[model samples]
Target: MTAPATSSGIPVSRIDPYTDASILDPYHDYRALRDAGPVVRLDQYDLWAVARYDEVYEALHDHEAFLSGEGVGITEQLNKAQHGSSLTSDPPYHDTVRGLVSRHLTPKALREFHTYIQDWADRLVDELVERGEFDAVTDFGQAFPLALVPDLLGWPVDEGRERLLDWAAAGFNAFGPLNDRTRAGFPLLAEMGAFLHRMSVPGNLRPGSWGAELVADAQAGKIADELLPALLGDFLAPSMDTSVSALSSMLWLLGSHPGQWELLRQDHGLISNAFNEIVRLESPLRGFTRLLARDRSLGGADLAAGSRVLLLYGSANRDERHWKSPAEFDITRSNAAEHLGFGHGIHGCVGQALSRLEGHSLLNALLSKVRRIEVGEPVWRLHNTIRGIESLPVVLRA
Candidate 1:
C-alpha cells in the first residue's frame, strides 16, 4: 500500500506545543486530522499522527512492531541522553522496569490506599460543601488528586500540589512542534526534571512510601538501581495530572448533562461505569507514540520499521468502528467498559486502578451528598499531550 500522503500545503498541526490552543481546545483540530485520513504527517513537527481508531489501537497493541523506548511524547534527540524507563522502553527491558512498577502500583497495593483515598474525598467535599461554590478543577479535581499522589509517593515538597500543578502544565509541552508553547516551558521542564531527579533519589523518600518501596525493589533485584530514578519520575509525572484531568472532565460531563447526572444520582451503583463513559466522552489525553520495532502493516497501511506513530487514543474511543453512536456521552451505555481510556497492552497505565478508584470515590461522594453538579463557563487547560478542562465553576445546591 502506498504511504499516506501528508497535507503538505496545509500544515497538519500548527498549534504551538506550549500554547493554549492545544490545551484549551484540540477537538476541532483532532477532528481535522482524523477526517483527513488514517495517517497524517504533522507538517509542524514532521511526525506522523495515526488518526483513525483501528490504526491507533493497532499501533499501541503491536508492541513488536511499534517500539516505545525511543521516547514517544518528546523527540528522541531531545531525550537521547535518557537511559531506559518503563514508559520509554519496549520489553524485555520495559517489561523488567514495568514489572517492578506494576508491583507497587498494582490493584492490591491501590486497595491498601483505599482508606487514604476515602479520607481525601471526605475532606474535599467537606471543604467545598461549606462554601457551596468552587472551581471543581482546581479546588477539587486538580487540587485533591494532586495532594493524594505526592503524599503517597513521599515527594519532597512543602507545596507539592501547587508546584506540581505548574510543573505538570509545563511538563507536557513538547508533544508537537517547538514554538512559544514549548520554548517557554524549557526552563520549567529543566527545573522540574532536576528537582524530580533529586526527589527520586532513595534519600528523598520516607522509608514506607512507594518511592522507598521502589528503591527496595531495586535493591532486591526487582529492577536496576540506575533505572529506579526514572521509574519514580514516571509515577510523579503522570499520576496527578491524568487522574485529576479525567476527574475534571467527568465533572464537565456530569454537570452539563443533568439527566445523566440524575440517572447516576438514582443508581449510585453505576459510578464505576459512569467514570468509563466520561472517558469515552472526553479522554484525559489524546495519544501516545510507539516506535515501530520493525516493519509491520496496520489499517491498510504498511508502516516501515522505526517509524514513529501516534496512537490517537481520543480518536479511538470515538471511533465509529468501536462504540455505538460513539460521540454521545451515555453514562448508562452498555459496552462502555471496552473503551481504552487508560490505554491497552502491557504498557497500559500502571496507575489506572488508582485513578479509577479515585474517580469512583469522588463521584460517589458527590452523588451521596449533592443532587446534581451545576457547572458554568468551564475553561480548559493549555497543553500538548493532555486533554482536560482547567476551570469548572459549579454551585452545589445541597
Candidate 2:
C-alpha cells in the first residue's frame, strides 16, 4: 500500500471511502490507510485521513483544535445544513444544546427503563427462539430499538413510525462527500426534518417524555423554536441506527464464533465487555470528519487551518498499534471498553448509556433463552457512513 508523498511528506491515497466497493468492505482500505501513515491525505476528497488509534483519539479529545462547529460532514452544504445541531457544533453552544437531552440519557435517569427494556428483550428473544429462524437485522436488531425508542421519545403511534430507520440511516449518509449515496440522502433528510418539525410542537409530543421536554424548553425560551426540530433529531437518529448496527453485529459475531457464545453464556457477567468487543470489531459509524480550527500538527502531518480531516473511529478500534491481535474478537479482552467505537472525550456519544442498556438487556435474554446460534451469510448494506448488515438468516436452537 505504497502512497505518493506530498512536498510536506504526507502520504497520499486516492481511496474514496464513500465508494460502493469501499463501503461494502472498508477494512481493507482502512488497513491500507493505517499502513500508509498516521495521517494520510485522501486525494479524492482533499481531506486528511486519520486512521491510527493514537491520532484519532487525540483529535477527538482536542475538540477546540479539531473543531466540530465547522460541521463534521464532508460537504460544505450538508455541514451548513447541520449548523444548529449538537453533532456539528462545538462548545458553549454544543454544551448548552446537548445538555437539554443529556439529563434524560444519563445512566441514573435511565434506570427506570431497565426492567422495561429487559422484558422487551426477553419477549423478542422468545418469539425469535420459537420461530428458530429469522433475519437478525430486521427481526431483532431493527425491531428492538424501533419498538423502544419511539415510545420512549413519546412519538405518535400512527405518524411516520415506519420511516425512522430509513431516515436515521439517510441522516448519517448526508455526512459523506457529495456523491450518489450522499446526494440521494438529501430528499430523505428533508422528509425527516419535516417530520421532526411536526413532532417538535407542543401537544404533539407526549408530555413528560424527552421529546416533550424539548418542546417545553423551546416554549420556555430555553432553546429556540427552530432548534427544537434539530434537537429532537439529535436524540432520535443517534439512538436508533447505531444501536441497530451494534445489536445485529452482536448476534452475527456470537453466531459465527460459537466458542465466544459459550464463553458469554458461561459467565453472563461478560455481557458488558462483550458489547464493547462487538462494537470494537464492527463499529457502526465508519467515521466522521473534523475541521481543523487552527494550523495543527496531527501525527506528524502538519494540517493547515480550515482543512477537513476524517477521523476513522472504525479503523482506530482495530489499530494494531493500540490493540494486541486487534482483529481477533475476544469478549474477555479487559480493555475492550477502551475502543473508540463510541468515540472518546467531550464529543463522545451522549446517548451511550441507553445504548449499553439496550445491548446488555438483549444479550442477557439471549444467554438465558438460546443455546446455539446458527447464522447464514450476512448481506452487507452499502451506505456512506453506516456499516451495517441489511439482512442475516439466523436459526436459534434452545
Candidate 3:
C-alpha cells in the first residue's frame, strides 16, 4: 500500500478497509492507521480515518462536530437511504427515537429474560457437552440471539425467527461502501425492510411484547407512524450480529486461552468482565462513519465540512495510547470495561445491557457444565462493519 497525502495535507494510505482481506484481520492495518497519524486519509474511500482512542472517543461523543444524521456509513448513498433511522439520526431527534426504542430493552425490562436466556444457554451447552463437540457460532454464539431476539420481540416463530440472522447481517453490510458484499445484500435488505414494515403492525406482534409495545407507541403517537418501522428495525437489525460476533469472539478468546477459560470457570462472576475483555480485544462493529458537520481541525489535520470521518472503534480499543498492552486479552484487566468496543457517548450501544445479559448468562451456564473448551480452526464471516466467526469448531470437556 502506498502512502500519499490528500490535498488538505492529511497523510493518506491506500488501504481499502472494506476489502475482504482487511476485514479478516484488520489489526495490521489498524496498527498502520494509528501509527501513520491520528487522522489517516483513505484514498481508496476518500475518507479520513480516526484510529486512535482519543480521537475516536471524542468523535463518538461530539455528535455536534461529527454528525450521524448524514448516515454512519462509508458511502454517501447509504447515508441517503438510512437518513432517519435511530442509527443515523442526530441528538434531540436521536434521543427521542432511541428513548422510544429503548423502553423495551431497558435493564428492568430485560430482567425477565435472564432466566429464560440462561436456561436456553444451559440447554444448548448441555447438548454440546453431551456431544463433546459442536460448532460454537452455529450452535452457541449466533444461535442465542438469533433465537432470542425475535422471540423477545414477539415475532411469529415461522414468520420472523428464520430470517432474523440474515436480515441483521445484511443490514450491517449495507453500512459500508458499495462493495460486492454490500451489493449482494442490498436486495435482501430491501425485502427484509419491507417485511419488517408490514409485520410491524400491532396485530402482527405478540401481546405485551417488545414488538407490541413499539407498535402501541406508534399508535399512541409516542413516536411518529413513519418512524415506527425504522425503530423496530433498530430493535432487530443491529442486535443480532453485534451480539453474535461479540459472543463468538468471547468464546474464541476463552477457548484459545485455556487459562482465561479456566479463570472464567473458576470465578463465574468474571463472566461480565470476560465479555467486556473479549469485545475490547475483538470489537464486533469495527468502525462507523461520521460526516464532518463543520470544518474542524483534529490531530493536526484540517477536516473540511461535509467530509466523511471513520471512527475506528476496533483500532481505538486496542490503541496503545489508551490501554497498557492493548492487544493482549486479559479478562482481569482493571480498565477493560473502559474500552470503546460497544462504542462511547450518547449514541453508544443502547442494547449493550441485553448483549451483556445474553453473553453473561451463556458463560455462566457453560461454567456449570463444561470443564474445558477445545477450539479448532475458527471460520471468519466478513462483513464491512461487523467481524464474527461464522463457524467455531469446539470440543467441550464435561
Name the top lDDT candidate.
2
lDDT tens readout by residue for model 1, 1-398: 12445433222444322346554665555666666667666544555677667777767777877877777764666546445667778878887778766776787877877887877787777678778878878787777667777777777666344677667666565554455766787787777777766765667777788777887787788776677767876776567778888888887888889999999988988998999999777887667777777877776566677777777787778877667888788998898887777787877877788888888888877877777678898877666677787688887666
How many backbone clashes does every candidate have? 8, 0, 0
Best by TM-score: 2
The global C-alpha lDDT for each of the candidates, from Candidate 1 onward, is 0.73, 0.89, 0.84
Minimum summed lDDT over a 10-residue window in model 2 is located at 342-351
Better of 2 and 3 by lDDT: 2
**lDDT by residue for model 3 (1-398), tens:** 63877777778888777778898889998988898888998877888899999889888878899998888988887778886577899988998888887877788988877788888888988888888777878887877787778877888767867777888888888888888988899878887888778877779988987888888888888788877888888888667888988888877888899998888877877877788999999898898989988998887889999899999999999899889999888999998898898788877887888898888888888888888888998888888989788898888888
lDDT for each residue of candidate 2 in 259-289, tens digit (9 for 90 to 100)? 9999988999899999999999999888899
Candidate that beats the other on TM-score, 1 or 2, i.e. the better one: 2
User: Candidates ranked by lDDT, best first?
Assistant: 2, 3, 1
Q: In terms of TM-score, how similar is model 2 to the real structure?
A: 0.98
Which pairs clash inside model 1?
18-181, 18-182, 19-181, 23-382, 23-383, 65-293, 67-291, 69-88
Task: Give lDDT: candidate 3, residue 177.
Answer: 85
Where model 2 places Cα greater than 4 Å from the true spot, the runs are none
Can you give the lDDT of residue 231 in candidate 1?
82
